[model samples]
Target: MARSKGQTALNRAQIVETGLRLLNEVGLDGLTLRRVAKELNVQAPALYWHVGNKQELLDEMATAMLREMSGGQGSDPPGSNWQELLAQAGRGLRRALLRYRDGAKVFAGTRLTDTGHAEEQEAHLRRLVAAGFSPDAAARASFIVFVFTEGFVIEQQAVHPMPGERAPGYDVTERAEALGPEFPLAAQAGADLFGDYDARFEEGLSAVIAGIGATLGPRTQS
Candidate 1:
């Protein structure tokens, strides 16, 4: 149903939600302002009030998606260890992103943004800094976690998607299989790719957490 002016007061949050829905249905390239407006039942011009343009809208959606993934973990306890807390936040964000189709792509470069994801990163940054990390180290460490999580998600999504009837196009798997025994590693992992993401994500995450922990200096005596 088309909304009246009284109901047309959609904010950026609503706009980003609409964008995410469109992305899931039509995907990135097929997504457009017209599509979003049609889904929202508003004129395209109305979106400009929230998103400015398509690139801005993409950036907004990316930020919004990452922010949505950042929650469900309760607040850090007072005086809790910082390394564990940081890993918790990173895993929370990655798990949230995994719930949606093509979620990683939707979240690219969001940490560098001032939008929703940046707000989440700021929270992580605060905890790290308070734990005696320098601002630069805090920033660098947060970024390492972000890159690993997002990169892992991207690979997982590409090499794996939900079981469904594939649409007509180049059969990617056919080409991959045709590469033959020369690509022994790829062939061996081919079947393994169908395994549980939760297991792999956790496995990868544990290593990341361990790596970060190894680099930490002993606590300073106040």
Candidate 2:
């Protein structure tokens, strides 16, 4: 089959968008350049022209997801303090990851293909610096916050797998029963550990932010 003259030329953005949709439908393991190409009615080699390989396509998808999360502008809300800013970023990132199947796994360890996020990242570091953190400390603290959110979401997706869905073997009640009466504390802790993700994330994010502040010391007047 030949592409018609009216057909729009393929681009990186189109490929990434298609890949994300496929990710939701088939998950990270099922998503492939060939599938994306088929979705776009193009040959697999055509996708390679825009994305060198599957990993490159995944990187592009992650970048696109983050871009969408930031609404194409990564700035903290007005008057947001460093702690507030850190918490907001964590929450936002988690929401973004939850938007796709295996999102955290796909996003983790992938390099951004472009510098679009650099300015926003710089702004975050600058804000922290103004809050009295040394440049290195600011970077480290920011990374810690990010890593915590990523790790949390990875575990979250593993248990939930998808929205309104739960993987087998993770049921709190079943887990408690499986542990039997001997492991009372462990059985009782199931609800606290596995239930109420929103609350857990907020609590964990708050604790992380507090720890960062405590470890980094008092913030100077900006």
Candidate 3:
């Protein structure tokens, strides 16, 4: 497959941007290098110059999403404590993952293509260390918060799927009814479990941060 005539103008950034736009339209399953190439009006072979395969493209897209979340800079505001920094990072990450359809899925397992995230992580870990967490503890604490945020968004997307759209079978009333009268507590819990995502996320994040502080804080160290 020969390169497209305009392939010279194509770059990795443009490919990633186009891939992200198409992701919202067709979703991760539907997105493909060929589809992206078509959107960019370039030959499929042209994309290989920037991304060798679909996974590579997805990795790039994921990295781009993170960059957008951080605004291409360290996100910590001045004077923020470690807990505040972790919470802010969690909230910012959730917002970023919610921006595109299946954004969480896109970001979950892919490797980033650049070092920008490394810089942010280094700063985050350093802050945690300065706050008296051992390096290993800091890494674990940060990872716990990160995974909590990622998992929350994954489930949120599963329930909502798309803006103004609720996936079938998640209706609180119907869910409660299906559980029947025998399971009163489980049925009643459906409403809280399935709805109030924003509040639930904040509550969950707070708990995670608190748990880290309790277990990994300076005072907890032996």
Candidate 4:
């Protein structure tokens, strides 16, 4: 039953929660102020009082989701090494994004400044700095991890085939036959590269972590 007028009030959290639900149901494109308001049994204008506009709402929703994910793994256990910690974070982030359809799309380039999760990000940067990276390098490394994960997941989700569609990536077999003797290596490489996406992601992620570690110099552990 709908609440009476006096009890029918909306707040920012409520609006954000409702928006997240809409995103999960219809994804980013289908989410709208009207749909959110309707879900809450309130007028569209009522939502405006809480969120400035759709972009603002999306930003808050993204922030909330990220905060929740980061909160669950706030710190590494005592005595854990930095590489292990960073790897765990990378995998955690990927798993969080995979929980919702288009999650990477929702998160790509959404800054977390002053959004309640800034401290968490800062702590990560500080951890890198303590491991001997220059302040500037630490910042760049932090950004790179997010960028790599976002880009990787965006491509992964985009290419995932829907029902009745062929699997993702190329059909190199037919192409190899068409090319005949002209491009044997290219066709074989295509087939090899596209086969195991999970392994591909792990290999890339390990490479990225190693590259970042190299930038920290010999002081990475001390």
Candidate 5:
């Protein structure tokens, strides 16, 4: 059906906004152009005018999310040093990912093309370089923090086992029992191996920052 006169034509921003909402509702797998078009009351062809295909739509969705996650809102002030900067970014990334179901799953492998995202990343790297890290080390440290955050969030949001179904892999007790006395330490520790996620993330974030700090050695006079 053709849209009536005075009705708003679908645009890229509206399409992306609708796509993000659908992503949170049905996750990446269920998100499709037809679904978005239906939700927007536009024909599927209308959606193509904005986004070429499903993969292109996903790229836009991922870019929008990365822009938001990359401090586009300026929610917090810049950190004093690279360590503090990295810590803030790590926490921010995890918090942003947690906002949408399967957020990390959507973001992990996609490369962002948005200009805002590039600026945010540049700011982060500049802070690190200014804090005594060589450019190469700064880049590596940034990836380390990002990878750690993504990896941690993936496990944190792992599948929720349905009633009467087998528990997810995080259930250490099941695995420990399966191992029996042959792996005594594993049995004894049980779920303790996983530790508390919040505490573990903070500790791991600290360790990553500290490891990067160690690489700096002494701060050279600028």
Candidate 6:
């Protein structure tokens, strides 16, 4: 239930964080404004002044999480060049989201669509443009990366037990059992698909960046 710096005692970020704590304990289905308020030792109405209703609280929590992913202003410190900076920024964002329990789910839900996360997108867009992309292309590519990463995170956390839910989780091999042997790849790689999300994420991201890099290769004089 940590609060943001420079925010009030009953700030939006604090309320959002309280919500996240509730999510961890009671889960999204069981989460409610009252539950969060009770945890924070405040009246629900007091939380409303800052965080609004449950849906808004969820979105704001997502925003707070994304900003936290952005880290301290200089945390992603620019490396030797824009390439390094872009990759470092990307890696920082990726690592931040991966650190929390259900980190991807929290981030994937309302984080990017919210206004606060737009700043992070804009910063990446600026870096991409400097790295030789047009504004539109940079923006598009960055969005793709965000979407892909979020989806990956959520899928990875799906096995997590929520309140009142029974799960140490199911077997991935259950699905593998259904596939026919003609699917040569599934016979070998099904486990890999359901497993090694971190490696899969990096592989996908590397492919994305490589494509972008190739597109912008070797600028020439007109």
Return the top candidate by lDDT: 3
Q: What order do you get sorting by TM-score, best first?
A: 2, 3, 5, 4, 1, 6
lDDT of 1 by residue, 1-222 (tens): 355867657678888888888776776678888899888878888888888877788888776665566546667667777767766766787776666666777677543245545565688788888887778877777777878888887776665432342334325466557768799777667455645667887787778767765675224744
lDDT of 4: 0.73
lDDT of each: 0.71, 0.87, 0.89, 0.73, 0.75, 0.64
Residue ranges of candidate 5 with Cα displaced over 4 Å:
1-7, 71-79, 159-181, 187-190, 193-195, 215-222
**How well does candidate 6 match the true structure, expressed as C-alpha RMSD?**
6.0
Minimum summed lDDT over a 10-residue window in model 6 is located at 160-169
Q: What is candidate 6's TM-score against the reference?
A: 0.72
Model 6 C-alpha lDDT per residue in residues 63-155, reported as the tens digit of each score: 676677665545335444445554555566666665555666666556343576566667766766776678876666666666766676666
lDDT of 5: 0.75
Q: Lowest-scoring 10 consecutive residues by lDDT in candidate 3?
A: 1-10
Check candidate 4 and list the clashing pairs.
Answer: none
* Model 5 error, position 86 (Å): 1.0
Residue 58 error for model 4, in Å?
1.1
TM-score of every candidate: 0.74, 0.91, 0.90, 0.78, 0.79, 0.72
C-alpha RMSD values across all candidates: 4.5, 2.4, 2.3, 4.1, 4.1, 6.0
lDDT: which is higher, 1 or 5? 5
Q: After superposition, how far is residue 10 of candidate 5 from its true place, in Å?
A: 0.7
lDDT tens per residue, model 4, 50-145: 787888887887788787788787676766655665667777788777666678888886655245767777777777677667888877776677
Candidate 3, pairs of clashing residues: none
Question: Mind giving the per-residue lDDT tens digits that candidate 2 earns over 106-193?
Answer: 9999998888787788888898888788999999898998999999999998888788998788889999999999999999999998
Model 6, runs deviating above 4 Å: 1-11, 72-86, 109-123, 160-170, 173-187, 214-222
